[model samples]
Target: MTTLEPAAVADLVRNTLAAHKSLFLATAGSTGPWVGGVYFAESGEFTLNLVLEDRGRTLAAIRENPVVSVVVSTGSPMQPFLQAQALAEILGRDEDARARELLVTKVPEAAPFLAAPVTAVRLSIRKWRATDIANGVLPGAELPSPRLP
Candidate 1:
């Protein structure tokens, strides 16, 4: 098993995050596991910003359990996609301004959606695993060692 260089893997992850419009967020709830699609913007190399309905189940679940999994993909076999393990947090009012800017900058169509009652979320990505068959990278080939520093 050959491990790709960290720089190469980082670039793949960054490009995938930039090209994708949304991500599938999976959280554990009292009922069970729940998954939902939500628009996101990369706030940093290891963090994502999201605007979710304040009363939504996803947020409710996050409040109960901060650990979550997120996937950034278009569901195309020919393209690259990434899976990440992250810790979720509901941003406070003071942090919302910056998160909102990042979201609007990435997805202009999301501006109106911000008007509704919603809150900003931050996903602190811990590890990234990616697959790019087009690049001859098989599944799990790009998994980071242990976790991101």
Candidate 2:
């Protein structure tokens, strides 16, 4: 088993985010836990920006419970993995411009569909767990919530 310092862990997380464009977001809805794959962009340190339908189940679930879980992986065994619990803040229409811009810039194909009836959600990571077994960091390690930017 290998170990990683907090700074290294943070860097690893950032690198993982930079290498991936989408993550699995899990939220608790009135019905139950709902998971959705959303394209994301790192808006700031420890903050991720994603757009979702304003009236979609994911957004609805976020409104009901602002705390959500997110996972980013390559669908491979355990080489790259990041799981985080974050506080979800639904951006108001007026405040979502930047988020939309970031998303569109990262995913140009999504531009036309980002118009009205859609809004941005910022996930502020609270606690996180990560591992890169392929790199020899076996098992995994959980880190305390890093400082917010």
Candidate 3:
């Protein structure tokens, strides 16, 4: 069994988001169907930005089921064997105004997109978990005897 330090977990989340420019967002539609997409970011935040029109299923899903999961990976085919996989989970909904503001930071290219009908949302992270797949153990598994930061 492995243990992950708080700092290590935070770093993994940040690095994973930064390294992977695109994210596969999964959402539920009005009828309880799963919808997913590859979305670009204008910046890194607990929240994400996308064209509202493009997220018909997502929006409806959020309305019906606000609970959602976001998976950010290294996109490495060798990830499984490595024992350490970097990923983050964001749970919540995006607030239009707040999401738009944050989006501008990561994706300045969305300036025009903001004006174009869009729904901005934020994912409030209720709980987060990170692991070092390479270690073949959970996060923080190999702690130094001294427990150095």
Candidate 4:
């Protein structure tokens, strides 16, 4: 697999984030495992922010375990797809305010949930992979590693 430089990876990740509203999150719940789709936002460093129901299964699982995997993809034929293994945790009071602001900008659809009792998760991405990131390549065939520093 080819590897991308930090700047290029950040650019591609940002583009992927901007291009998709939904992301598939995989988590290990106390009962078992789960995968759910959630709307997301990205921090300047590209950390993923998710607003979820406090009592939802995904959140419950997150409380049990912070580790998670997420996939953010672009449907445009010309765009690349990005995925990451991340560690998720509820936001602190200090972080919540800013994260909420950022989240609202990307998904105004989340405004209602922000005011309610909800779980705000920040996924600190550990590893990232991309497809169709190469100049002349087919989508999904190449696993390009984004060695994020």
Tens-digit lDDT track of model 2 for 1-149: 77988888778887888888889999997979999998898865478899988778999999999999999888786658888889999888776888999988888877876866788989999766888998866666676665742
Cα lDDT of all candidates, in order? 0.85, 0.84, 0.50, 0.75
Better of 3 and 4 by TM-score: 4
Predicted structure with the largest TM-score when compared to the true one: 1
Per-model TM values vs. the true structure: 0.91, 0.90, 0.62, 0.79
lDDT of 1 by residue, 47-75 (tens): 89998898989888998999999988888
Candidate 4 local lDDT, 1-149, one digit each (tens): 45556666667666667788788899997789999988888875448887888778989998999889887764454567777778887998878787788889989998988888887788888766666645543333323334344
Error of model 3, residue 12, in angstroms? 1.1
- State which candidate, 1 or 4, has the greater TM-score: 1
Question: How does residue 31 of candidate 3 score in lDDT?
Answer: 79
**Which pairs in model 4 have colliding backbones?**
none
Candidate 4 CA-lDDT value: 0.75
Question: Per-residue error at 145 for model 4, in Å?
Answer: 11
lDDT-wise, the better of 3 and 4 is 4
